[model samples]
Target: MLGLFIAQVLNGLLDGTYYLLIALGLSLIFSLGGIINLAHGAFFAIGAYLALLITPYVGYFGALVAVPLIVAGLGMVTERTLFTRFYRIDPLYSLLLTFGIAMVIEQGLRWVFGASPQSYNIPDILRGQVFLGDFIYSRYRIFLIAVAAVAVAGLWLLLNRTSFGRIVRAGVQSPEIVGALGISLRPYLSIVAGIGIGLAGLAGVLLSPIYTIHPAMGAEIITLAFVVVVIGGLGSFWGVIIAAVLVGLTKGVLVAIGLSSWSTAAIFLLMFVVLLLRPRGLLGERILRFE
Candidate 1:
């Protein structure tokens, strides 16, 4: 029983990786561009479908590399064509636009792939279990955790240690000042959108083996991703990380305690309590545009 409990806790912590991937992108796009991208999940779904298509020829490893780039390119295009118009305006407009975008992508996927759920087998190389003492875990999940960690760490370094990141951070706080300095944020916006949407794509690819691949999969996961972002505080990078862990921990504990049915509800309860205590989120910063 004790080993089971420990295994569940570890599993829960690793599960946070998925939320971290999706929420980071969601937070980044909203923080910099002020666009609440409802279609973000659609990109995730697209990634999974793309993987299904490309993996046959290029193999899983190849699809893993190519899918995110493809989705990111699509994201850049969407930002240039659609998202650019809605910046600096009422967020409602962008929200509605993204919602429409989401619907269109979902339907387009349905039209192309049909409404059926698809399956992608785990690559044979990663198909196995890792036993640590009495606790056993999926090898693929361990790999997933490692990939997520690297992605998150790399993103942190990019945002904190690079010139591009500095400009983005500044723009998020004061677009007017960034513009005053003659720094055109247009290219940055497109790139950020790509990076953000691309993260979602990567998540899609990683999870495709384990998750049920269907048109509604993106829609199903987006809400939980939003919860992570909200709990972590909008625009707070570290906050999102912590919140994902907490959310996963909460669910894991519930399951471990034989109250699995309440796991989902407990996550909401955790969010409600956090909001009651800190309205701006765990680490949300004061952005002039949001203020």
Candidate 2:
């Protein structure tokens, strides 16, 4: 039982890692651009499809590198062609535009790949089961944990330690102020969009082997990601990371103890409770109108 519990906890953390990557990117872009980015998930699907094309040729490790690059390029294009034009509009316009793009992307994927889930296998070296206390865990899950850790660390450094990160942080607080500083923010905005969608792509590649890779695979996760962002406090990047992992762990604990029904509602309930007591979310402040 002890070993089993440890293994389950590990699984939960591994799961949370993917959630963190996806939510972290989403939160950052939303903060900097004030765009809800509903099409972020479409980038995930694009990554999966890119991985599918390359995995057979370069294998899993190479697929990881190639998929993100391809999807990142696509994300850049999307930002320039679609998202950028909506920048001056209200936040609702951004939200609606992205949501519509997501619908189009999904339909395209369904048309090409059909409605069935596609199967992907982890590399041979990373395959098979490893034993811990006579309980076996898949090596792929362990790989996921490692990959997630590195990705999150890289993102942390990008957003907090680097000059680009400093610029991003400044823009997040106030885009116009950053713009007036004699810096062309359009380039930065495009780069941030690429990073955000690239992370989503990475999540798709990470989850491909574990979950059914279908046209609509991103929908459920997108909903959960939103809950995490809201509960973590929108416009706060690290808060999203912390809250996502906690929610992932909560789901694991709830389901492990036979409260499976609560697993679906767990984060939502937490959000509701948090908002009731703290309207600004866990890390946000209520925006007040000027007198």
Candidate 3:
């Protein structure tokens, strides 16, 4: 039982890593850009598909490098043509617009790729297991955990150490004050949207070897991602990290207890309980949005 619990904890923590990536990006968009982007899942799905499509031609590493750039470009275009229009409108308007975009991307993928679950072969380099005392662990899974850790740490440095990150952090607090200093927000807004959606795309690409890729894959994860984002609070990246691990732990423990069906319900319950008690989330500031 102890071994099983330890294994479940490992699984849960790794699962939380990807959830962290998705929620981190979502929090940035919500807090700074003020876009409740339902289309985030689409970008994630696209990243996966693009990786699959490119793998045959470019190999896995190439796909990882190339697909994110392509996804970032797509995100930038999305911001310019669609998200920009909703900037001055009510926040709900942007959410609805992104939701429409999500639906359209889903259908488009279905039309182009069909509704099949596409498989990705794991590279031979990461396919084995490491035996530790009485337990064995998959190398690929450990690699994923390490990668997720590096991703989060890198993003933290990006947002907290660099000038670009500093501006973004300040903008999250209040864009108005930043804009008053003569920095035109239009370009920065596009960059931020690109990064948010790009991170989703990156998440998708990394998930290619871990899960079957399909049109409905994004739909499956988005709800969970939203729960983590809300649980972690809207504006705080650290909150996203904590919330993601919590959700992952909940699902893992519930599955171990033989109630696999309750995974989604578990998240809903956790979010509800957290909100009921904390109201502003673990680290989320109360009423960050002035409107």
| Reference-based TM-score of each model | 0.99, 0.92, 0.95
lDDT of 2 at 43: 78
Q: Which ten residues in a row are the worst by lDDT in model 1?
A: 282-291
What local lDDT score does residue 151 receive in model 3, on the 0 to 100 scale? 73
- Could you give candidate 1's per-residue lDDT for residues 12-82 as a string of tens digits? 88778888999999999999999999999999999999999999999999999999999999999999999
Query: Which one wins by TM-score: 2 or 3?
Result: 3
**Tens digit of lDDT per residue, candidate 3, span 1-291?**
888888887677667887777787788777777888899988999999999999999998788778878898899999999988887789989988988999999999999999888889778898999988656788987876777787789888988899988888788777788899987778878888888888888888888898889997888889889989988888887899999999888888888878999987988999999999987788886545643
**Rank by TM-score (best first):** 1, 3, 2
* Candidates arranged by lDDT, highest first: 1, 3, 2
Q: Model 3 off-target regions past 4 Å? A: none
Every model's Cα RMSD, please?
A: 0.8, 2.3, 1.5
What is the RMSD of candidate 3?
1.5
Q: Candidate 2: lDDT of 280?
A: 62
Q: Please state the error at residue 69 of candidate 2 in Å.
A: 0.9
